[model samples]
Target: MAYVTPAPLTEKSTRTDALTPLGLLTVLLGAALSSIDFFIVNVALPSMGRDLRASPATLEMVVAGYAVAYAVLLVLGGRLGDTYGRGKLFRWGVAAFGLTSLACGLAPGAWWLVGARVAQGAASALMLPQVLATIHATTRGERRAKAVALYGSVSGLGVVLGQVLGGVLVAADLAGTGWRMAFLVNVPVAVAALLCAVRAVPDSRAERPRRGDIGGTLLLGAALTALLLPLSEGRATGWPLWSVLLLAAAPLFAWAFAAVERRAENTGGSPLLPPSLLREPGVRRGLVLGLPIFIGFSGWMFVSAVTLQQGLGYGALKAGLTLVPMGLAQFAASILAPGVAARFGGRAMGVAALVHASGLVILALTALWVPWSSLGPLALAPGLAVCGLGQGVELALYYRIVLAAVPAARAGAGSGLAATVQQSCLAVGVATVGSLFLALAAGPGMREAFAIVLGVQVVGLLGLAALSLRLPRRLA
Candidate 1:
């Protein structure tokens, strides 16, 4: 099939050619795929290990490889959408994602599965940024606000649903495919998304497209890999020499990346991530605030899955079902967040943080007091639901706050940079918090370890509340 280039939207055309409802749904579907894949494999890890005879380290790679690759390539993906066309990239990305998901489903060995997962991550990197970029470019004012809120709702729901769906698929074991079904399901979904893209999804790109920043891309990728790779693998592998070296080198790469970006901007070349963009108060503060929020969020998810399945002896489906209350509450809160933000302004974030921390406190108490035999999904539901509500609010506001000041001309780049920060932090959260839980579990037992981790997370939320107070009273 020949590619049909979409007409570029002028300022006037943008207002006139609103993103159709189906178009928003199509892009949101694509966005959900990326977020869903990040966590879908969590519940399937035990199944995968049994079937493949995979080592613990390889299992970590299965999750980390996808996240690391996705985080590293996101900015380039955004730039490509800006220079080419978002609709074209969306289709290409969806196609690539489908193929990669197939590769993962059919892998014959542990290493092959890891490689396929990395490729799947790369495809996600390509697809996800376009969703935000397209929404940023195509809609404005109240429509833009609603689109973004829905995006946030989908994103949060996707993460929870990934685990839920993974559990259901693994338990169903369709045709005895077992864990592979978790990935194979994406094949049909991607095909549907591609078909919808052809009709419903509009193409949009930067008005003044900038050339890809090769030097900056390489430097940024290296910097992120250096930082995230060690944190992800070091604990499981017993913190080897290579991991320490990578950790030590991370800062150097980051400094070099900064210098290169600064030079590119000074030379009038478009940097992969412009330093000037970071100077924007919205962008800077949003990132600062997001670090703790996502770090705590992902960390909790990672450890919760492990504790439910391994410590409590819950089945995959049961463990996945454990999060259902959280997912439902989160979706509800996300839908209501825009109105809440409009009324309470940035204070809503602080309130949300407090709510999230309260949930963590509840979980910590339950973990400490409840006997293992009596504790189950029912015992955890209230805390999880509260956390969900807080997370929903935070996520919607975070996107609105971050992208509020970005120019339409740089929508792709700006959204991509924001996403990279989010994805990278998620990977780090899993590693750091997961490692802490594992270490404590080994010594103090699962119950004590869980309580400790929740305590740490609560402290992070307190910090987030403090930071949120600094956000401008009105979100854009």
Candidate 2:
């Protein structure tokens, strides 16, 4: 099979010859915030509901709105980054995110909070693609590998940290801010990142920047919004007629978007997503595997939150603390990922998947056999640790495989698409798996529902393992 090497990175019109440590950390902060915000709000939901007097459906909006907006705008964000400067866009995104977080922190009502969260998601979309794109453009060989590994590790850690930090912030209620602290916390972090980014992060853009395709962008956004909005909000909204109509229109919009993109590509215009990029075997196959992995990852967080807090009668802090072991394991695995991948090739992901599945099985059995009242965080520690480690490894390897194949010029688009798939799957996972647990819990009991969901995820993990076989044995 013939493969094309991506265009080499264009020389930065800046003083720095390479991305500095602070530069990398600043970008990683953007990546971390994007992933963290997705799960962080989960632990803060109860507190938000109580403080705002929000209905169940309104509460769901606070979460789904962000995911929907983020998924819809990500590809465009990438295009904009390629056209504009990555450093410029990233700094603006970080600043915007901080302001939005402040808005969220100060929101006096549920609807206000939802609006702020949507804006925050938009900022995230702009910021996050640049991280991967910047790394891909500026770094090479072992440095690139290490950077990507850390990126993946941070992605996993962000999810875990969200729960822990959200729990802590709400529990602390510093200055009587209560739940508002969760969003408010981002203000300082974003400030720090922005300051470092200006000095350290090199400004880089596509060698051949293309004009944005308005038709393709609109159609793509319409397609994603139609598909994701309904899935994320339908359960809460009782699957209304609008949801059905949107769902029905989703495929049409998607097909139209693809057609528009293909036309744009053939006409020498840069489509929002260049159709040719999808032709890469690595990108296509890695995306396919990523869908299920993200689904399981987000679904596990959602289910665990409900089970630990609502089902097991644990406090928010205790529930958060329970996952500490898993987070540690995830951190360790991520740190070790580059070496492991070098040794084991793509099969490392398969091994990781098996370990993840085994952990899920253990968790399910613990839920099934142990009495609900008797089950404690410690009881689930071992399984959670193993699952986290697998997740870290899987994430690191998969990211390396997918992005390693992308050309430098198209890095923004590739990274955006990857993040889009990842976030979309996360929203879907929360909706489907969470809905399943809620429905079953309404009758069969929470313990049974919990086990059943974990069992379902175990099957998905094994499927991911199978999918890993198709990835290139070694990255480029």
Candidate 3:
């Protein structure tokens, strides 16, 4: 279990090593695994429900538990990599993810599956940030730009692919594992990634590694958990006292976390998330713009799965396959993103947001007019493709601008901060937007509820459009 320590980096070294193709592939796999698992369980939920005899609430936990664990630990995971070595942390995380996936696959009951999912999420937190941090620390110029674009593509595709792959795996039911294959599939992928990472991913860490920020990390995690847990589970559990209390406690923990971060700065110690990073104009503005884009995206995915399966009576495989247009459009747009960014500069975010909003409107209209029994993949394809295109381009541009502002010396922490925003917003999207849909559907028809939720998300996208205008016109 001993890991090789990477040699110390000089302060002035602009780049550490040339990123090999194998290294890029290895890191992208880690990113894919982290993101795919988030949504993959969606299509498999019905199967899991029947197989395990789980209630509606427990099925929600199957998704929320993993997201909460992953989102909370992300900042600490990034810091650990900065202090120890990104390559070392990446290896450990991938290995742990494999083991946790096996645990999930073999789970004997609903609660055991939930526990294993939480552990899988923690492992993802350890592995994912290092992907961006490594690219930032090691690559330069066109190479860095290309790498970032590919990262965006893989990320967007991961969400789409999760749905597709989940449907395939569950339908195929390899070895008669049924829905269990959704979790089990990660085992072999993780093993291959770990081996490639050891040889290809260069070892990199912060130039001045410092002591961990235990207090700030805990406080920040507490705040996020307080906020997300209630929203994710409150409706299903009928708004219990604990859920209400947790929601009320969120703001206090957030305030305390901010204070602790400032104190660490005054004492000349490294905080898990450095406050200075947010002070940069591009970094600050980019995070704001990126937040709503991801929130709406994840929310749409969650609601779509439910609407397709429960509301419209589609099979899991059909529901998953219905997103094919979205996946294909996103893949194409992501590859074209770097060139588009080069041409449009920062205005690309505004453009992408507009495109995204337009797509959402189209989707809302489609859902409103089409009868539930009459709707099919063709009815949803146009809007899904448009949304995917905008999402792909904006995601790439946001990642480029947000991290480009950070000093390489703080790459790991900066990467963590950016990813924390991304992951946390994703969880919030499901908790708030997804929960709102579910709550409404209970009272009204599913079609009516979905249209209303899509309208709300359109407003969120409009907000993103406005925020995008404030970012710097170009990344450094």
Candidate 4:
């Protein structure tokens, strides 16, 4: 790997940036893989469950394990990339992700896949944090803004695309590979990006680097897992006594972890998460909104996939294709988001949230109105499209809103916290919303239960809408 520190792009340097496009592609492609991993597994889960004779608990573990591992390691991942060179770490993470994906695809049993997926999540954390940091370190002004917009779209779009792609891959069976095709598909794309980086991607490192906090890192990881695991796995397991005990202990562990971090900072080491970032108003508000958004979104995906396939008898490919319109709408909206934000302020977040809620409402109405056979893309198109467009616009805005309030010195900490909040919510979504859907489905058929759960999500979306009203529309 090359030791190329990021230089700001300028008129003179732009022409010399032969690797710029390649570098950007490599980064984007790597990011897309992580995004896909999150949603793509949805369609694949039932098949995996059948193949492994797994209970619902195992299926939840498969998803939660990856999310928990990824969330726990994310701050450390970003810090490691900063301490080491971005390019070197990014390349290693990408390569490891490829290996882990292969391991997941070829898994002999459910537990094995769960373990591999956790590793895959860790590799993703290492790579994803660097994607934005690299864009930030290397580009400026309009270029930076554009790159950030794309990053935002890709991040959300990944979930949508993953749903459809997983459906297709699992349904197609891809030479009897079945669910493995979903994971295996990442291999070729990763190889191509690996080649691109060899010639194009530049290296970058942290300025005013701080010592890594091993104690803080471990404590933070433990605290996050301790909180998330009980939530994600407990509902499925009927809230066993141990789950209750784990829930009780989460706060104590978190408090102890924070104290350890403060002590570490006093000793001249960088805690994986800085206490100061938490005190920043905008970043804190962003987390408040982000938590519910991700929780609702992830929970919706888990429930919908099950509803569409097992309940409605749609194939995987069909389930995946259902989200295509939303993905397209999102991509279109994200491209236009910055200009809109510039004119209207952060008001876009609230409006987008309303649009998203409307989309859910529309879909819910369609489900209620149409019989099962009549409900397809047409029924979901308008709401899903609105949701997608609004989501893309706000997601981009969230990045700016969160970071706008922080100093450059605190970028990694700020970004890491943002990611942690989002990921934690996603896990909670699976635990709460997803579990609720399944619980209800046992009494009704899948379709009705799904409708009921989505109705609740509409409430969550409206809450986001209300929160957005609190944002001062005159945004940066």
Candidate with top lDDT is 1
Cα displacement (angstroms), candidate 2, residue 168, comes to: 0.7
Highest TM-score against the true fold, candidate = 2
TM-score of each: 0.96, 0.96, 0.94, 0.91
Q: Evaluate residue 262 in candidate 2 and report its C-alpha lDDT on the 0 to 100 scale.
A: 94
RMSD of each: 4.0, 1.8, 4.0, 4.1
| Model 2 per-residue lDDT tens digits across residues 91-184 | 9999999999999999989999999999999999999999988887777777777888899889889998999998998899999999899999
Residue 188, candidate 3: C-alpha displacement in angstroms: 0.9
Candidate 3 lDDT by residue in tens digits, 1-476: 01112235544333456568999999999999999998999888888889899998999899889988888898888888888888789899999999999999999999999999999999999999889988888887778888888898898899989999999999999989999999999999999999998888887778788897889989999998998788778877888999999999999999999888988987898777878777877678778877787888888888998898889898888998999898889889888988887887777778888897788888889988887799999999999999989988988887888877777767777788888888878877887898889889999879889989988988887787787666656554
What is the descending lDDT order? 1, 2, 3, 4
In order, what lDDT does every prediction score? 0.88, 0.87, 0.85, 0.78
Listed per model in order, the count of residue pairs whose N, CA or C atoms clash below 3 Å is 0, 0, 0, 5
* Descending-TM-score candidate ranking: 2, 1, 3, 4
For candidate 1, the lDDT comes to 0.88
Model 1 weakest lDDT span, ten residues long: 1-10
**Which sections of candidate 3 miss by over 4 Å?**
1-17, 439-444
